[model samples]
Target: MTNHQETIKQLIEQIGILSRKQEAFKYEIFELKNKLDQLQSSIDASDNVEKATLDQTDYVVKSEPIASGHREWIDSNVHDEATIKQPSFQHHKNQNSKVTHNTPQKSKKLSPFRKSNLEKFIGENLLNKMGILILVIGIGIGAKYSIENELISPLTRIVLGYLSAIGLLGFGIKLKKKYESYSAVLVSGAIVILYFITFFAYSFYELVPQTVAFAMMVLFTVFTIVASLNYNRQIIAHLGLVGAYAVPFLLSNDSGRVEVLFSYIAIINIGILIIAFKKYWKPLYYSAFGLTWLIYLSWFVMDYSNDSHFMLALSFLLLFYLTFYLTFLAYKLVKKEGFAATDIVMLLMNSFIFYGLGYAILNDNAIGEDYLGLFTLGNAVIHFIVAAIIYKKQLSDKKLFYLATALVLAFISIAIPVQLDGNWVTLLWTAQAALLFWLGTSKKISIYEKLSYPLIALAFISLIHDWSYNYDSYYHLEDNLITPLLNTSFLTSILFTTAIGFIVFLQRKGDFISSLKEGSTWLKIVSYAVPILFVFSLYYSFRLEIEAYWNQLFSLSELENKSISDYVVTVNDYSLRDFKIVWVINYTLLFLGVIGYLNYKKIKNIVLENSILVLTIISVVVFLTQGLYALSELRDAYIEPSIYYNRGSFYLIIRYISFAFLGFSILSLYRYIKKDDIHKGFKIAYDIILHITIVWVVSSELIHWLDLAGARDSYKLGLSILWGCLFFPFNRFRYFKE
Candidate 1:
């Protein structure tokens, strides 16, 4: 029995060991299978390409594989197109509800946090604390010094403040190197502040201050010199330095050899050279050169006070050199930086200077006799050289070589003696008109760029022509008066103005408002004032034009005779202020202003937008009521008590207002009737236009009946367009939105 039990135990032990080994083998096999499955999944995931459609703000992904080997077509939009072949038996076996879990793909766009950092760099602009601090201290300290010193007046201090503001000017220089930016700003700021405070604060029991002030001026001058040497802050440094230069020049007035002036020039020249050595230094060099030349010219004139002829010669040479050197620099800059605004400004200023010099040579016997044809001919050569250089570089910049060429031509057209009928200036004027028209319509240039120039030129021509005609006619006082285009006489100039005012009303577009906004506040006021003034000036002239002694009357303006400008007093027959004519002009202006109202309305088809239409209607009513009163006064002045119409064409202001008012009334009436507002009799919109017309008609009749006021020797105090809130003399504050 014992032997049988021992055999069973041995067999049991062996069987138990075998069973444990088999179970361990099964566990290892299961782990290996899991590892294989995981490896396969990872490879598939790595190989898969996520694809998407680009929306404006988001991506729409299509879970697809990027096609391999067709590399040219792949983008973020590629689709996953890989196919896998499984054995039929294995597929059938593994087809028991196969599960899928999605794996999210990494996106191409960065997270919000990363994007925020990127935006901070680009959007905030020069996140420079040091630069800003320097600017503030410079401006603040300069102001403090000026106020305390009273060395200068308020206007001058403000002007210098603008020029000396060198603090934030690092950006202007574009000093891109990191360490350079820091070192330059810090060192320069420290040196400048110390120099100014030490000098400006100079006083010794206030006794030695005169000497100290003189000494400080020298040291400050030196600092300005060194400041100009600074790569990024030349302009500001120049501003501070110029004040010192100006004080002595003003006191001396070219009488003595101002030694201080020569020192100033030397310092400025050094600054110019320093800036010139930079990788790109056109703007700085040009500015520096310009300042230096101006100073030199001023000194030359002063030193050669006896040698007016030599001074003129030297000035011509200096100016010529200035043109040549700047042109060289301009050509170089265009090559490096391509077409830029700097190129345009440099071109414009230099061209104008050259032309002005040419104009002097052409028109004035003084410069003409000295320079002969050199400024004109030499200017052309310089222009050609610039053109060749620009063309040779083959630059593809949009500013192109054409602007330089056009500017040169434009300048030449005016400055070159148009000896075509030997009536050199008349031909020049004709060419001016032609060129002005061309530039105004040219697609390449902007309206703001050259549009005003032509109009201004036209104004100058008219003024000159009228003044000359007046002199010639008044010398004869009757016979030499011949009406040219719209008759640009003292009387016809006003009427011509009214005609042009009508043109402006018609051409008025939506862009005008934007232009008004973008333009200088003063320019905006003037642009509107042109049309209004034309109307007023015409009415005044027209009423007086019909009066008896008017033909015998003469108003000799301070025309070409500039020496008479200061001595110009209000002489009886020749008062330039001539306010006695303002009232009838005001009345005629009111009578005719409806033209502007209509055209302004028509041009702004979207006048209703932002209630400009309502504003327009209100303005029209206000002015029209004023106009009625004006028309009555005009009749009293121009017409006989017994008869009706006067001699001569109806003043443009009157014609313009009548036609314009009728046009607007018809249009508004049509719109109102269509809206059924008029048929139902005067809603808010209908009544606005109706009231406007009523005011005009009633005022016109009443003025004819009552004759409220004539020639306003003391300005007529009334609801005249000149004084009203709507239209009179233009609202100087129109540029402000409020």
Candidate 2:
């Protein structure tokens, strides 16, 4: 009974182990089926050109149970990710075995690795291009040889060319499916040959009517385009376009029929535009754009006339511009693709080229130049509409959207200068610049902020032009009749100043600035150079205004009909010069005083602090050199005022006031330099400079006054008295004691 029980227990244990083996085998079968399914999918994608088969009779699966200890080793190896060999399956193939395996071998031509890159290039691209080129050259040589030998009539020659082209086309179409790339080369050659045949038939042989020849060539162009579309080849379309664009020039009779030429080019471009919308062939689109404009520009430069071709040229220019504009945006608006860098460049070129050509056309005509600004504004409106449409549609092409928005603003900014004259351009440009900056900061758009820079620069350029125009002695005497501060030029300068300063102010918000690297050149410009420009513009404008007022005052006094002010008096020209200089000096003092106040207020701007120190140094130098001389001249003139024009106390009071303001400006600088945060070394140097500058200015003023009162010969005595008076103040200071 015990022996029988042991036998039954061993049988049960064996059964349990066999059951686990069965589960493991089932899992292996599941994995094998999944791999087969994936292989089938790959074959389907390749059009089943390579077949794979798994025959039951060829592959034999065999399994054997392992001892428990060996199974334990296998399990441990699997956990350690070790490679363990399992039972093998035998695959066999024989005539009587009823099993066959098939995996189609890849052809050498189909496998790219079979050939080196040089061999492939020599076999594929170079050979095709060179062979076609050689064939075309051969045809030309043969035709020329035959013509020279009189072996064929012109009609026969033309007929032979057409037949050759037809034969090539037939061969290309036949071989297209099997040899698509070669077919493309053949088709391109055939199209070129057809174009030559058509041109010779019409222009050289006169064997065909012009209309018929044109229609035939157009048909040929259409066929080439269709073939390329079907074959998905851009090279064919490129060759076809080249042939199409060549037709007009090839058929040229020198009749100068630009209208017909432009019309034909327009038709060609329209087809290209259609292709752009249909396909993402950027090269084709750009070629069409470039070729169409090139043809138009060439004709305009070589043969265009204003009176004869003005309206016709205008129509065609607008048509071509609109076509390219639409085509450039087609991929974005229709296909919803983002703008590549080249796309943005082409778009910009299209716009500006059109504007420039249009401007030339308008400027050449009588009434058009007057409305050139309007034309520019019209362009701005068109782009604005485009931007609006893009925004409304909410297209995801952010680059294109930003570009469109920038274009609208750019056009508007440009139109100001193109349409308006003089200071009006500057004024409007500044306004636009401010608007762009505000939009940039508020909308968090960096492009707008960058664009604002150029507009502001343009405004500044325009402002300078106005200044030159207004202050030009020759021009001012004739054209400048407006008031000083209230004129358009001054207004333009103020607007420009405000706009740029506001841009600087907005930059302080750090919204637009953080996008820049901390120590970039542009950051330095905005931080340092921009503030200096502001101060310079302010100071220069005020100086010009003061000079302009005196100029207007004198010029109007000379005019009997013009009364600029109630106190217009005739004075010595020398006195007038001195008065102008004195007024400017006082204004400078006031300007410097205001700047010092800004520094004293602790604006915490490095540029401001440096500007004040630099300006103080400059002022000290000028006071010692030019300023003292000018002051003495004024005082001399004041002592000897013209009896006819006693422009009395204003001049004297201004001189004294200038001295007072100068002292105050220096004191402000001294206080700013003495601040605890300032470097002790900088403070010491600045204190010495300011003390010497103030003492020299005060003693000079007193000595000059005493000299004017007939103490000129006692100049040494005056110096001694002045030093004695200043010595008491210096002795009280701790630096003097040290």
Candidate 3:
């Protein structure tokens, strides 16, 4: 047996060795086949290329005139393909030969104008320009320190600054010719250093006469602007603007020289505006805007206490406005990029600054704060007029129109609250909302349509603010009461919310159906919100009236001291009043649900239809539950009279109302579930709930009547059995049918 096993093992080992050799042969054969296929494909591709080249040669010769150079180019490509050994290299060589031979004449013509290696070498090297920038700023700071410390004569520092600037300018011009790319940085650095030096020379050290210093500054600005235009680079413009704005801060010595500082800013901005007309540099414009406004705001905040600065503020405001307007013209009219987000932001920023400065001027008693509204209104009017002009000229972009409308509405929103007291503000906002809605829906003016949503939202927010005035009064017991709903404020709030809802509903009619069908999210939101907001307004008005009545009925002297839980304990005492309020709310909800259903029928929106149905069902359920609870309370009150005097009448009313609600809920559930296409499971759930409700209502009434007659326990048991048998079969039948 052992020998036989050894023979078998030997045989197995031999078989394994033979299997390994077989696999090795298979892989080698696969690789060889792949190599053979690649070689075949290469040969085929080469043949196709040659054939294509010959066909092209024939076509070119027959179809059009062929230059000798072009004919030679085709011949050279074919020769390269035949001569090259490696397939890849030969293909690339053929392509290059074809291109070179074809464009030979054009290349010869353009070679002279192409950049040389030396020029590229210099242009790529910016270390020298960066070093010069650092060095110039460092030297300026050092020179300023020397002058302040009296280490060197101011006149000597001034001369050194001039010489350095001149040397740098010359170096820049040389670079401009040699490299061109790095020239802007060098030139800008020189201009900044020179401007700083000139500013200190006149405004700080008094080393030069004011006239001479101003002339030198103007000359530097003119040179900078010219260089910036010549180079067509924004970096030069940016540096020049930064240096110009910085001069005021560097020279500021608590002399309260507001006029001179702003005058300097105004001149610098004017130069920037001119540069803007030539080149559209967003960074340059933004930097000038931010720095100028920041400096002006800083100066106003720090020095506006001095009455002499009023005129300075006025002049600077006008200058800033002009500068912004000019930039606007540059973008809208010159560059014709149309109005963009940046333009809108700049306009808003300008408006804010103008308002801030105007407020400051008024706060200083330079003008009456009451008349501040006049200024705001005037600004709004101007913006509206400008918008009208833009619209008339057909230069209005959506963003531009939106910004313009927003500014006007914002000013109006602010001015109304400030100028008018009491409920007038609310009325104004209501009118504004209506106007915006009208404009948004108008076919004549398309631009305002884009702004309609946001503008209406703003008006709504303003109306909210207007409604807050009556909040304290509506809730207050006595001493805190100020403005009640009987007053104009609350009345206006109600009227305004209702009118807005009406207008929104009217405006949406044209497109609401299409919008709904297209699944427009915003339109759906507005559609739902309008009715809900109107309902909320009515609810709030009712609440105010209820609170007022409650205050008159009870002494709320201890109201403030009680926690919410403590107040809830007393809630049952006013159950009757709450019942009345809830009854009104229930009917209101039902009415709104009906309206929603009608809208859904017209629009054929599933979401709207389902939402209204669900809301109505939930409301009915709640009303039924509350009615039961209220009846229970009334029954208890009749048994133990505290606030009521008619026990018999209270009990009768409770029973009648409870029966009425139970019947109404049952009918509503039946109608809701009877609708076709409802899911079987949901219908079954509704049937089960209705059956349970009917049983409870019947049991409760039986129990109440039985107690009144002093019935025995057997009667209750019999009634229970009867209800179970009837309801169980009915529910089972309903479920199976569903």
Top lDDT: which candidate number? Answer: 2
RMSD after CA superposition, every candidate: 24.3, 15.5, 20.0
lDDT by residue (1-738, candidate 3, tens digit) is 454455556666555445444434444443344344334443545563323433433321222111112233334434443442321211234443433435547565564523654564565555666677688868878886986698978788888888888788888889885456676677777787788778868777788776676566667767777787677666676766765666556555666667777877787887787666545566777788888888877777666754576656776787797678667755664444544566767787788888878766865664556687887887888779777776777563545655776688778878887788767766776677667666656543444444555555655666666556555455445655544456665677677767767665665576533212345786667667766666566656655555555444333422233456685333224545554544454454545455554554565555555555566556656655775566666565665665423346755464665465445544554555677876676576676667666666666666666655657465658686878778677878778977
Query: Which consecutive 10 residues in model 2 have the weakest lDDT in total?
Result: 60-69
Tens-place lDDT digits, model 1, residues 211-322: 4545555655565555555433444454445545443432333444444455545554554444343323345456655775575555443443333444454455445555
- Is 1 or 3 the stronger prediction by TM-score? 3
Task: Tell me the tens digit of each residue's lDDT in model 2 across 1-738.
Answer: 454455556656555455446544444543454345444543546564332443441233232211122334334434443232332323435445432337565675474653666786788678988888888888889999998999999989998998998998899889975566788888888888899888878987799987788789889889989887776677888877887898777777788788888888888888877875565677788888888888888888988899899999889999999998887776666554545677778888899989999999999999998988899988888888888887888654557778888888878887777767887888888888889878877887889878877787787787888888877652246465666688767777777888778877877665555344679998677566656667788788878888887766655444222236765554334566666766776677668868778756756676577667777767756755566677677677678765445556665566676677677767767767767787666677676876787678777877777766888888788788888888878878857647
| TM-score of candidate 2 versus the correct structure, residues matched by position | 0.78
Query: Positional deviation of 610 in candidate 3, in angstroms?
Result: 2.6
RMSD of 2: 15.5
lDDT of 1: 0.45
The models' CA-based lDDT, in order, is: 0.45, 0.73, 0.62
Per-prediction TM-score, please?
A: 0.35, 0.78, 0.66
Q: Relative to the unseen true structure, what is the C-alpha lDDT of residue 672 in candidate 1, on a scale of 0 to 100?
A: 33
Compared to the true structure, candidate 3 yields what TM-score? 0.66
* Best candidate according to TM-score: 2
